[model samples]
Structures are given as C-alpha cells and as structure tokens.
Target: MKKDIFIPKVENVYIAVVNEYNEIYNSQDWNAYIINNKDVDLEMVLIVTSGYNEGKITSTFRKKLERLPAKNYAKIELMQEELFALNNTFKVSFFEGNTMYDKTFLFRKNTINLKALQPIPLMDVKGVLVK
Candidate 1:
C-alpha cells in the first residue's frame, strides 16, 4: 500500500495559467498568473522553469511581483507557443502578515493541446523528453 502526501489548502494567493484577460483559459499562447484572492496586497516572486526538447536544454524565467491588490492578479509570462512546448514548473513565493507561503505548480506536457490554432509549429528545443 502506498501512502498519499497531503497538501494543505493554500488560501489568499495562488499561481495558475491564464489568458491575456487574466482568466482561466486555453489559448494559442498562455500566460502564468499570480492570483491574489485575499483582502490585502501581496508581494511575490514567480520563477518559471521551462524545459525544451532540442539540445536537452532548460531555461528559467523570473519575475519580481509586488503590491498585487486584493482580488487582482499579475500576469507573469507568455508561454507554450502553440508548438513544441514541453512542460513548465511555476515556483511562487510570497508573504502575508509575516507568514511566508511557497508553492509549486507543475504543468506537464499532457496538459497542453499541441494543435492549438492552425498548422503545426516548431519546437525551439529538440530532443527533450516530456518526463
């Protein structure tokens, strides 16, 4: 038998993939969003790790986000270029009332729709594996 690891519910803020309008959506290009659902403002740092297939390369995208008002969200980066985008890991760190919060969101290749809009696109990186 395998035991399951429990992840406590993290309130106040979270990171997710959204559209240009900052809503949960799927599009030709998706953006990472830091959603502040609390009553107070939030300061955070979002680090996005993108892995490429060609040349077995991995790159990091960093954004220092600050003063995100309540009920608002900040768009971080435009990703998954409707082509050979492999996977992404979003690492978010923030503080609320002296309590620090950190979480990671993993978006695997299976979550992506390869045929987003029109004809096929090209992958900048070539031989990277999804796993």
Candidate 2:
C-alpha cells in the first residue's frame, strides 16, 4: 500500500526573508514572502509560521489565501529583528488541480542575515531563500 501511494514533489515554491527599507520608520525591516514560480495556480494556500530556539519560542502565525496566481508572489509577514536568533519555520500547504502539496521551509538560527542575501525568484529584492 505504501508503494502504491503517490505524493507529488513540490517545486518552484519558496519562502524568502527580505530586508526592506521602511520609509515611515526610516529603518530596515525584515519581511517574509511567499513566491509561486510554477506555471499553474495554487488553490486554498495555507501557511503556518513560527520561530523557536533553546528556551524561547515565538507565537505561531497562520495565513490563508484563496488562490495564488502562477509566477507571482505575496508578502507573508513582517519579522522582528529578534526572531533572527531563532529558527524560523514556514509550513505551506496548497492544492494544484486535484492534488495537494505540502512543504516546509526553515531558516536555521542566525542564518537570516545581510551577508546571506541573494537574488530571489519572482521578486525584485535580494534575501535569504530556503528551498
């Protein structure tokens, strides 16, 4: 039965953290984004995000989108600088056609930093991308 079960592999979807300038605050802010690079649209998209470390744990956040168009992106949330010291995890689940796909993207503790910034797919800014 296990051999007969089929689970599709998730591709072209990613979670990225970007450091963007906040004109109102006059400071750089860390933000999370969901990028959908697939050619097909995703339906009932859900994302659960949280951060944790040795003795510290941040609150879990749940976000839902009715649909995410192909080759597009959306902002997930604003991350505080303090969360950088903890392991940030983003659990994403969505349906493509009649198939459901799930994936978890993690940014290990202290891994989200300026030095790690790189060009992100489907976005104009550079940031840390976890595939």
Candidate with the greatest TM-score versus the true structure:
2
In model 2, the runs with Cα more than 4 Å from the true position are 1-3
Model 2 agreement with the true structure over 1-131: per-residue lDDT tens digits: 99999988999999999999999999999999999999999999999999998899899999999999999999999999899999999999999999999999999999999999999998989999998
Q: Identify the runs in model 1 with alpha carbons over 4 angstroms from their true place.
A: 1-9, 19-28, 52-55, 82-85, 114-131
Q: Write the per-residue lDDT of candidate 1 for residues 1-131, one digit (tens) a residue.
A: 23574434557565555333334554345555666767877765445556555455567777887667777766677765442356566677776666666777666654544333222112122122121
Candidate of highest lDDT = 2
TM-score, every prediction: 0.60, 0.95
> In terms of TM-score, how similar is model 1 to the real structure?
0.60
Q: Which ten residues in a row have the lowest lDDT in candidate 1?
A: 120-129
